[model samples]
Target: MKIGVDYVKVRRSERLIDMTQYLLDHPHDLIPLTFFAARYGSAKSSISEDLAIVKKTFKERGTGLLETIPGAAGGVVFTPSITDEEAKEYIESLAERLSEEDRLLPGGYVYLSDMLGQPDLLRKVGRIIAAQYLDKKVDAVMTVATKGVPIAQAVSYYLNAPFVIVRRDSKITEGSTVSVNYVSGSSERIEKMELSKRSLKRGSRVLIVDDFMKGGGTVNGMKSLIEEFEAELVGITVFAESKFKGERAIDDYNSLLFVQDVDTSTKTITVVPGNCFDKE
Candidate 1:
């Protein structure tokens, strides 16, 4: 019966692995202990012990935070986070890559599609942004489409919040929409952006994110839309911000990278870490 006992141990090990995977995948969500106990046919106490081990490992590795709520209805919720040392290193590397000559585009825009598309980079960005507002109760994440979608999604993933997209044009499928007019930061032309009325609830605390910012017109437009929805703008962040001649449309904001200078003719770009690293 030694083999049978070993098999039982193997099954328990498999259950632990599965439980950890489930918790990691469903960050910011409460999973009932009974659900897991029923799913794995294990005792609640055993599941608690397993989660304790998982939580310890997660803390040691700087993977994320696993919060346990005590009560009959309580369970576990994961909050993704990155250690400071890792965040600093990642941001520094990203600044170097962004400064590459070939990444410079026309009109001083940097080509960042590849970086945004990478799952690893997005996760890092999300964790960094989420860490900043960990203490705050952020109700939702908002971004102006189409480039801002990825960054917003990443941040929302870590924050365990839903995201809403603001479009340049209102779509009929969206039902009712609230439109706001603002100056286009790059073009210096008046432009309008809209969001679905049903997307954001009233009095929500929102965090805004975007891929890039210059004069902050698009971000300002989103801010205005948030006001129209009767929501509060908790904070604003961008992937990168350009050092431009004119004053920025908005003053309070954070960014991951600052494009100090970009020479399209020479194909040279200078980048530095953004306000996110600034000491408050």
Candidate 2:
């Protein structure tokens, strides 16, 4: 081991920096220690020490989790996460934005298209959602077309998983599509949605995300599509959920914001932190 301040020490420091970046870039991916050892021209022992430093820093910073697997075929995986405090803070801010009187629209609809365009906010929301399900073995993210695309993309980015779009209209491009019928949450009218057969694999763990859910009928439609594909429903998350009266279609889901009441007469919208903050 060469340990001069100007030589091996500098290289070690550089290695740690680069290794941390690599792990962050490839979240939820398993990387073998041998690969790191060869890449840095250092022994496995040195790589392990470097990872220990990274692991500690990540934990303390509330950045994420570093999981190490031992044995011959073992490797390390980095999974993104946020502290409860951070999640609550961010969601509270989001709820405030959604609660604005100007966001209220005709027929009690809340306008949300503008917020989806903000990349920074989406990144935080994605990290929060992805972090909550890191242990669920999320293989793919699913969402309905149009509004939910951005949310799904953001979550998939942090989860290091691909996203699939379920469309209102079937396209010839996506061959052999699987379609499902679901009642519209807002209107209570039956509507059809479809997804490409080739987009998801059988038995794969799927995380469903959406922009907004009212009565949860649309989400239930996606759940039906999951069943048709023989994929497992890991969980569901939504950016916001409007107030729904009576029984909802689905029972379990997490949301960043809940629209408690939207009074069109007074143009007042009541928004609050969703159930994801229940433990807090």
User: Best lDDT goes to which candidate?
Assistant: 2
TM-score of 1: 0.93
Candidate 1 residues lying further than 4 Å off, grouped into runs, are: none
**What's each prediction's TM-score?**
0.93, 0.95
Expressed as tens digits, the lDDT of each residue in 1-280 for candidate 2 is 3456579778888998999889989998899999999999899999999999999999999999998999998989999899988989989998899989999888889999999989999899899999879778888999999999999999998999999999999888889999999999878899999999999999989999999999999999999999999999999999998778889999899988899999988899999998887744
lDDT of 1 by residue, 1-280 (tens): 9999998788679888998888877888899889889988889988888889889999998888889998988999887777888888888999999998888777767899999999989988999989888778899999988889999999988888999999997778999888999999878999989998889999999999999999898989998998899999999999999886788899999898998998888889999999887855
Q: Model 1: which ten-residue window has the lowest total lDDT?
A: 101-110
Q: For candidate 1, what is the total of clashing residue pairs?
A: 0
Measured on C-alpha atoms, candidate 2 has an lDDT of 0.92
Cα deviation at 225, candidate 2, in Å, is 0.7
